[model samples]
Target: MAGKQASVLVQYIAVRGDLAEKWPMGAIIAQACHAATAVMHVFKDDPNTVQYLSDLDRMHKIILKVPNEGELNALVSVLESNNKDFKLWVEQPENYPTCLATKPYIKTEIQDYFKKFKLLK
Candidate 1:
């Protein structure tokens, strides 16, 4: 009999640097939060998400930054082509894409998609 192996689940969030540079810190954080929340809600029933939430104290997230909206959109394109599950949050009224976040997934399973980006400081 084989025992179940443990996996490191992580949520990836990419926010537009241009927005973060110009917008208030709170607003920038809000964009990332919106994307994160949306993806989690959208994928709440996913196996990885379920396991990720099952251990809330160990939840892991990687926050990266894109230079601008175009760069962020470019990342989204790659994610879509790879069939990665994510939420691209577009603020209404202004209709601007501000941030994107992937649902909780095994780190190794999706790390390649974000290797080119740097962590958001």
Candidate 2:
């Protein structure tokens, strides 16, 4: 199961990377957020999804390493779209953990967003 999950995560990351390269920064972030959110949904109900979440965690770290308003805004936009309340919490640096905890929801929102955006087949 873990192996299968890992494979799925790898696929997701590869797709995300491709999107990042091809799309605008905001669009990439939006797509990544959507992808991560989809993974979260799968993770919540399927043990297979947990590995994908782990992949997302790693990707999140990479995203954080980037220094740009467009990137940050895109990331924050996804979070905000997932949870309106997150806007307030995200503003407070100390509440980062709380914001992290909301990743699942953010991920789920991203998944839905992807569907709406027609990023998913």
Candidate 3:
């Protein structure tokens, strides 16, 4: 198994579910986009990111929801403590910390950190 490679790389984005009640859908979606884009740019040189980006059609992303800003804030600490590479996007005009996006990583290695969240449906 020494030479085995992880075939599926996924990026995980977590958004604040409470925002749905306070903001328009477009605004919430934009925040997620900002976080995802920021992390990708920050880790553009990483091997997994490079491989994840190269396959444009197959790029995979899972967006989940945290109950509120408190949950989103806690996730930052969790990711930081675990040494996960990610971007926590704070909207400028309002200085609102909206969401976070993890750099593309092996699903099995990183999914556990996000297991508590539910898909944003």
* Top of the candidates by lDDT: 3
Clashes (N, CA, C under 3 Å) per candidate: 0, 3, 0
Q: Hey, what RMSD does candidate 1 come out at?
A: 3.0
Name model 3 segments beyond 4 Å from true: 1-6
Candidate 1 per-residue lDDT over residues 28-96, each given as its tens digit: 898899999999999999998999999889899999988898899899999999999999999999999
Best-to-worst ranking by TM-score: 1, 3, 2
Error of 2 at 89 (Å): 28
Residue 13 accuracy (lDDT) in model 3:
95
The candidate, 2 or 3, that scores higher on TM-score is 3
TM-score of 3: 0.92
Number of clashes in model 1?
0
Root-mean-square deviation (CA) per prediction: 3.0, 11.1, 2.6
Per-residue lDDT of 61-101 in model 3, one digit per residue for the tens?
A: 99999999999999999999999999999988889799999
Tens digits of lDDT, candidate 2, 13-109: 2122333444577654554455445545544754444544556445331132222334444545765666522221131343321111122333433
Cα deviation at 54, candidate 2, in Å, is 10
Local distance difference test, each candidate: 0.91, 0.36, 0.92
